[model samples]
Target: MVSLVASSFMQVACAADSEGTSPNNQDKPASSWDDISDKLKVATTKGLSKLSWGLEWLGYKSGFGEQCTFVEHPSLAVRKHLQANLKAQDRAVDVLVASIEAWERTHAKDHAPLVLALTGPTGTGKTESSNLLAEALFKWTKRLDHSDKDSPSGLLVFRGEDFSDNYTNPVSQYQEQIKSRLAEHLFRCSGKALVVFDEVQKVIPHTLDVLTSAMSSNAHLTYHRGGVERRIDTADVVFLLISDIGVAKMEQLLIQYDDRRHVPATQLENDVKRALDAQWTRLQFGKMVRQVVPFLPFEPQHIVLVIQAKLDQLSEYYQGVYWKSLAFDPALAPHLSTLESMLYIERRAVVRGVDVRKVFAKYGARNVETGPLQQLKSKLMRYARPWNPEAQFTVRLMPDERTIEIVACVEARANDQDKANEDGGGGAIDTLSCVSRWQGEFT
Candidate 1:
């Protein structure tokens, strides 16, 4: 564990060293190491200066804590995200937003935090909704940290899967990390920060015990930093545990209901409460949490909305890309949307059990692939490929062999249309696809 921490720092040192280089900047005057280091320090902080060093060892740009003067208020896009993506979760969203806003308004000198537990089955927007909330309050999703599943930030994340095996790394090491981070963030934020333990069910009881002091209202946490046990205050920090423990069975239990869209919030909350009871009791941290908000299994209508929302995200993303009218072929969107909806649910209450982001991520060239996926990946335009600067894109998935075809249509540019036509491959559907049976959908 210590070695892991050291390696993380080493990576940061490597990044700092590389910042001084440039292939073409050799002609430019080079700044002294001190000047460069100061500039790098300024750049390393991505707006949030108060809590910058919490993740300094990791070399990622840092975020400001809650109490930091530079933190941003929620954006319109974040509000729109909540309004568009989350359905039938009005209760949860309302409570969360209300509480956080209230916390922000309070003038109390002492610390008091709002703790929430977001529980639900897969693909029901629990995480997305949380992101929406975070974005609204924090200005950007990246500042929330661990938003990418594995990151360091004021919004600390504990993956339950990793914590389940304490034998591999001493739990005390993790405890130390969590304790120090929480203390730093809370102090920076004036006793307020969001800490998430995702996939909470996978964490062992003893490991969770580490969080008790941090969760308690007293905000007292005890851990050894330098062979000395130290205490810190966490009273202003909000703790959110995202759990999927009883969600599968809960879906099964709700299958007989006819009006799936209107599952009572109280009823869903109760279900989450029941599932969390056994573990909370075993872990002895049941009373610390303020509320259990259930993310119900996505219904067909929910899936439909989610798919459209996801597609819009894709469209909005590539819309700004250099030279292309990027869009899901209107003809093909319906088919892909249908497939996305089918993937979210299960036998009783299921939807795409997987995140749709992974699909959108396939377009990036950085990731490695194998077999036909690799072949399909190879079809993409390289970083510097030049077929036609004024080309448009339409994404299409052929029915068989799980083929995804990127259809690029070169458009007539006033200056180059004649040249384009003369060169051939002109004004036609240029197909980029691979041959393969992509069986990535849920069985």
Candidate 2:
């Protein structure tokens, strides 16, 4: 490959020299060989970079490609998604959108990546908000499209636990590994990237030194590999550092304000920043963070909305799989009641001035989805059969409250004996019978 490239460069240089010198005889000075060589070098670099980008777009893994560009203004789309999907995170959504808009407008003049520190309790829509931002910025149709072979989406995710302190390996080794991985992705994507570090509190502060340096203004990531040094620009990149640090403070602020929307953004951010600074006192990378966005704990109302959304999603999925329409009886009121009972062992917790929000905060929206919603989906898959396309199934909480029952509604005529046993004395009506019932423990 080296010889071939060299020969190609020589041929192009020779062709350019011939053309430049042959310029219709008189008035023009002869072109210098050095000038021809320089032009050829620029052309070769551009051609190779284009080729690498093209190959990557076609689903081939090119080691290095053109930098990924962002949408001109992704804040609108991001705001829309956050408002429509994420529940009870108005403050987070506002700060995130504003920060992104500002970055988009001034990124060319900025020296480093826009670093956002997302601090909150678990399952408070921190990760979900990150995903929404990635989708909007990259123009992805779905969250999973980031991994699609045809799409050259510039989103990279890292877990802090993966770089945590270990007895066997030195912290410096972990730092080097992170630097190498980040450099490779940044070079491949051409510095147009969104890098996310989830659970950053779990990582050793020393392990993130590379990130701190790369995120510094006027600093570029220098990757040394195969005897070549590649400088990856961080100006166009965005970094999201998600952690649960200072969640207690955030929760307290929320309680004090009675609502997250009422909490002063400046104060909330300062508290989170202080907590982060205290935790990472040795490294003090917290100073590099541009915005400290707080994802407040989920309230009961938010949890209910989350539960309803999950049910709707699950119902849509089951409908397609079963070839039958599924409906929830009286919506999500019963489900919420069941959830509260399962979450709180003692009813006095609510009576003793402990609001249900505490329970909602403890589990968060993610737990509700993964726990009760997952079990509900599993039960439907196991018991709900697609026997009749015309039949509709209703999911309702049984009288016992702990048991969930699936009832099938079939349209048929009832005789005298059947009427006596079934719904009163109806001649022709829909008869409902229990299809399946099971007691689910929401944990």
Q: Best TM-score goes to which candidate?
A: 2
Candidate 1 error regions (>4 Å)? 1-81, 84-92, 102-110, 128-132, 139-153, 166-174, 184-190, 222-231, 320-322, 337-389, 395-443
Error of 1 at 53 (Å): 21
Error of 1 at 414 (Å): 6.5
| TM-score for each of the candidates | 0.59, 0.71
| Top of the candidates by lDDT | 2
Q: Model 2, which residues run further than 4 Å from truth?
A: 1-69, 140-152, 166-169, 330-334, 337-360, 387-391, 398-403, 409-443
List lDDT for all candidates, in order: 0.54, 0.71
Candidate 1 per-residue lDDT over residues 388-407, each given as its tens digit: 44556556656763445566
- Native-referenced Cα lDDT, model 2: 0.71
TM-score of candidate 1 against the unseen true structure = 0.59
Q: Ten-residue segment with the worst summed lDDT in candidate 1? A: 357-366
